[model samples]
Target chain A: MNTHLVEPEIVMAYRDGQLAAGEAAGVRAHLETCAECQEIAASLDDVSAQMRAWTVEEPSPQLAWRVAGRAGKPKGKFWWWHWPTAALVTAVLVVAVLPWKRPPAPTVQTGWLPVGSVRTSESNLPLPPAEPRRHDSVAEIGPQAQARTGQLGGVIGGIVSATPMAAPPTSVQRRTQAQFAMEARRGAAIPVPTAPMIARDATLNLTVKDFASVRDVVERIVRVHRGFAQNLALTYQAGRNNLTATLRIPDPELDRTLADLRYLGKVDQEAQNGEDLQAQHVDLAARIANSRVAEARLKELLANRTGKLSDVVEAENELSRVREDIERMQAQISSMENRVEFATVNLRISDTPPVPAPSSVWRGLSEAGRNGLTILGEGLMGVATWLLEYLPTLIVIVLVFFFPVRWLWRKLQARPAFRLPN
Target chain B: MDLTGSDESLMLEVKQGSEPAFIALFERYARPIHGYFRRRMGDPQRAEDLAQETFLALLKGARRYERRALFRTYLYAIAMNLLSAERRRAAKDRGSTTDEPATSADPDAVLWVRRAVEQLDDQQREVLLLREYEQLSYEEIAGLLNVPVNTVRSRLFRARMAMKELLVTR
Candidate 1:
């Protein structure tokens, strides 16, 4: 027997029954005589037989219960199982019948302008001119801001100042606006270098019976606590009024201020914020000192300027720069001092009772009935509106369907009755 | 015995909602089906669960059954789906840095056979299992798996060749 005639793969193919009838016969003929192929076949059979013997360990008996229970639960049909065709049709209808037109412009009593008109710079109206006023240190900026800024700044500052400020005592926010105003007026008064006032601030919402009563209580607390209002705003509406005052209280008096505030109403939300500005204040003081020295040196240089024209120009320019730096440093010192002197307490006092809304649902219904009747009586108005909206499309559709309808009518009229089959 | 008639009539009765016929079908196929799962999973518990799941699947899928293939083939196909799902779920739940290699507690010969079968890519393994274990004809396996008969032959050939090489090495 030629060993070349019986390959291992051919033996396996025969074992697996994958070979063609003729090839299988050839392998079988060789297998009857060839010891090598026979051995390979026997090994293959042994491997497969062993594989057949490798059985999985029986699962825990409890699995049967779990599986049976799971299988017993009624199988749910998928959502897409019901009325699939109808759902498909509905989707198509929604895509077709639903209006995809862009929204019409809102009726503008101002003017019926094109949608993108506001986008053009050409149509942009100039803002109203600002009114001029006197330049008094405080009174000047006041009259100009009296209505808007006064309502916001003074009252807002009062509320903020009432809240404890986190900055050290030396910060300018520690100073009440009144004190800052006074200091600015005293222009040359040497600022007393005091330890920075550090005030911790807390935000709390309180419901109060009366805004005025709360305001008074807050003020009394501030005075007793050695704090002052930085900004105060009192808005009086028809039913309820709101008084938001930012105040500054001494850190020692913060607890008492908070206690007084708690008595005013139910505290809704309260959060305290603390800031440490000791390092920042020190840094600012150093910068101011450096700027002052620089300013002094520049001033001396300006006084003794006797050089070439270009040199003198350069020296004056240097002085101008130094003056700017000094002014900036002074501003920074004032701000830091304010923060240190004043601890900001922002108090928001809103009326406990909600105001009754005007023309609620019932009123709106009555109004709608009247308006709707008015609109219905003017039936021609709706017709006009619809006509204006679709006239172009209607004309195009008419032209498109006219010839088709005419041809169909002619064909139908020309058709003869069917003769009976003979 | 008329095997096709008995199986078909039994399936038809089961389809008619006969709980008895279902019980009979279960009794007839439970061990073979369990053995099939056991061979594939190498875990007795998982095999038993899978066997039960295959029966449940057959029961549930009865309403949609058109007798398109031999009920056994259809049943094994459902078992295959359940097995694939279980394997996927197991892999997902493992969540290990390295994947566990597929091996059985069997002797080297059996492990060699399984590894060799696994080494033949997915299509080939499927064809081999259907041919060898399920004893499905090439044409029947092709129709059930939605592949051409010729493709089934080639895959089976490749599977056999790979298995022979594995067995030779062993």
Candidate 2:
């Protein structure tokens, strides 16, 4: 036997039967002769013995019966229920949030004229009060003229009374006696030629290849059709040009002029309207004739002087009112005739360079890929910025609530269901 | 009464819907399974519950059983998983560690031994207990714990040495 003792680990390993056959034999030979090694081995065994001495209590008899009863029976299916429950919860959340996600309705404003005010034409009506009208030259006409046009027309031909007749006029009785004397001098005058009036207007939206060429072409078309451009505006911006022009063409040549303009570009939109003003013109002509008759009668009454001073003053006032009415009717009649002769055309022209075709599929795909990567990078950067912006709030929330939540969790854990009964 | 067969054969019989074979396996392993849980847990009732849970797990998994390893290895793996789950539950519920001082029948020698074993680190304690009580070899302990045999040997040796020192000093 060797004189020196083996290491304690070797001794423990030998006792544990962990050593190989030859090493176990060597340890065994040393242990037979060496009391110290034997004692160390005995101590290791003694530790195991002491640990093994702790008694293991038998499980209650009910456990075996319960487990046996469960045998040959299929286990309850738990995972099968989880999927449907998750889907139901998701559906409930979506339903609860749906209404809050909807956008709000826009507000609308409608402007109406005050009652008792009279308007002669549709153009005289005011726009909605919420939005101020844009100052376009074609729409503006003239501010002063527009204001005057909005007022009610004066009484005509005694058909519409300006004011209630208070009493029988002394001027009218004197005018009748004087008119009988004047009738012997001259007969009544006849009216001039009248025609059916129709106002023609059109709106066009055009996309043109060359803006400058289109303007020249439009001017040539108007000249050929014996028309004049009312308002011509050209705006240049960022490689694109926008043209807005209002032109007045001869009514007889309107169709030919519009066709020639359409040939200059692609017409994206067009609208035409013709309004008949024959009844309005006829009414005005009749009113003017009646007013002329009244004026002539009043002038005869003033010239005769068969009445008192009050009658003479009344007659002069009547004559002036009649003259003003006739003048207004005459002006309206002239304007109506001009509108019937000319057709108003509103044109909006946009000139933009055509988009270049893609060079090849590979180049197109590569461009698309580059754009996608740029968008992705921007999105990631936005997310990072948002997180950094809210980081302070997150930290404060964690600091304020972490310890209290942990303490409450601990307190709850200390309660009955968590801890075993003492 | 004729129950002399390998654990795999008995498990195979249980898989085939043989209730008698299942009962035989239960009778054979009930004590060791109960003792395993009893040594690890402080409360006897909880140990009993864990032992029953282990058997229940075995029964549930029997339909899909394959003869890959020894039935004892399969049984211990299930027991280990259940033990981990129970420890987690106890920790979450009680806010204390699972290896509390156990109430033994003999409080003098057994209590001292239990206290000394509990004082060791979790890995060393498990290795030592599996070796001493379960009588598993180093290779078996390595297989059960998913470590090398050398690690199991070293851990067991160190655990024994520490236990001896603790017992002697006290």
Candidate 3:
């Protein structure tokens, strides 16, 4: 009657038939005598009996069709998510291969370079000796340009002006000759300021059929005439398209650049003008000289200062202000000289359909549909390209992993939870 | 088709495309697997679908089925996978939160017992259910839950004592 109470764990184990026979006998003896152990045993059995109350019937047959065909693709609910895997792989292939199959985008050249920057120092170049002499302010630099080409065709600016600029350099070789002649005469006495120091510029408006081809031609002409685009803008719209080019051409090359530009399309309008910047150039030069003299005087004071600290500071500030003025005026003169050196041409080429049929809503909708179809066609092509390029590779990759994965899965599937080393 | 063969042997026959053999295994385990899902899921229709999914998984993976272990284990493994997936989906549908399985609508005593079982700690509750209803041995549960056998034993002990205490109070 004095057996100790059985532990709940042993009681449960005995109930579960897990205890050894000897342990079960001992627990049974304790249960027979001990009211507490007997209750624990009864409770253990009662728990199982209670759990048995929550019974469920067999499921209906509706779920039979879901697995009717090869697992019905699983709705990708499982870990594999087969459909998502396929979609992801397809997307990856599309991203990887489409660019190679798609046609290249249009290439439009842009950016600018310095004007007549061919010479580091123009005065250092060899001159075309005594090239020409003329009276009026004409294309003297232009004649020098044409003389090098040996064409002497006609007056570039106006007849009986300065040197008569002959004709367009017939060939690349002739243009090279002109460049060399300019390189030479640029040697000395190239009074870009007094070479009439005229800032010559032109504006040409043209309508062209092929904007791309004409743009290429315009680029070529600028290269030939030793010019560069200062700024160029293009508006490629559906109903209208235009290219505005602000070019900087050496004054001597202005005529040739204009001639080449003229041939791009039918000229809608053309105008050329020369602003005499001689007065401004002279004024800038005089002011700069005066500022430089003042700067030198201040420099002397700064170098050998014999004054109070505040006076020295004031003088130093004054000298700095004077030097700033000098540099500003010098920059203005340099800019003026450069303007005379490179004339600015504002040219616009447009492909706007002239006075034609008005657009209708129906036409717009038709255009939209056509655009959609075009996009869809390209998308399909991208998909097809991806399939052609990667499907085989993907299949090979899947094949590579399928057997081993299947083996491992079967290994896992077989055990279900029975044999573990630990 | 030997309908009365061992589970593994029947599964082998099922793998070999024996229709009668599959029907045999289905009849044998259908209620158990359905109960497995039914105990954890609130919806009977959902439980049915998961049960169907487990069998379908078996049918689909039959070719890959090997005889390295018992057929019931493999079948239960598939049922466990479907249950886990169903739980995840339910959790997501519930704003990404999860609660214990619901108490059944059985009669008064049965409902009390079910509530006490549901109120058990998750691992202990699961261990008790597996041991009690599914009749999985402690070692089988340890392997299924990927824990040591001692853990399964202690959890079962704690679960039974707690279930007894709960049943007494109610």
- Highest-scoring model, DockQ: 2
lDDT (Cα, tens digit) per residue for candidate 2, span A194-296:
5556788999887776565566556644643456788899997776788899998767667766665664466789999998888887788788778888888
Candidate 1 chain A: 10-residue stretch with minimal lDDT: A113-122
Question: Which DockQ values do the candidates obtain, in the order shown?
Answer: 0.08, 0.25, 0.20
TM-score of chain B of 2: 0.92
Model 2 chain A TM-score equals 0.40
**Residues A193-260 of candidate 1: C-alpha lDDT, one tens digit per residue:** 46544547777677665554455545544543456777778876756677788877656556656765
**Count of clashes, each model:** 67, 0, 1
Candidate number that wins on lDDT, 2 or 3:
2
Better of 1 and 2 by TM-score: 2
What residue pairs are clashing in model 3? A127-A184
* RMSD values, in order shown: 28.0, 22.8, 21.8
Name the 10 consecutive residues with the lowest summed lDDT in model 3 chain B: B96-105
Model 2 ranges with Cα > 4 A deviation: A1-7, A18-23, A72-422, B95-98
Q: What is the lDDT of residue A175 in candidate 1?
A: 45
lDDT of each residue in A1-422, candidate 3, tens digit only: 63556667777787888778999999888777778777777878887887788776556544444443334232223425243355457556655665543323223212211111111111112112222332312243364544533442221111111233344322111223344345433421112234346778899998776565455555544543546778778887667688899988777778756755654556788999988877876777677667667777877987888888898899889988986776565556556766777789999888748554438888878888999999999999989977886788667656665666666554544432111111
What's chain A's TM-score in each predicted model? 0.37, 0.40, 0.40
Per-model TM-score versus the true fold: 0.34, 0.40, 0.39
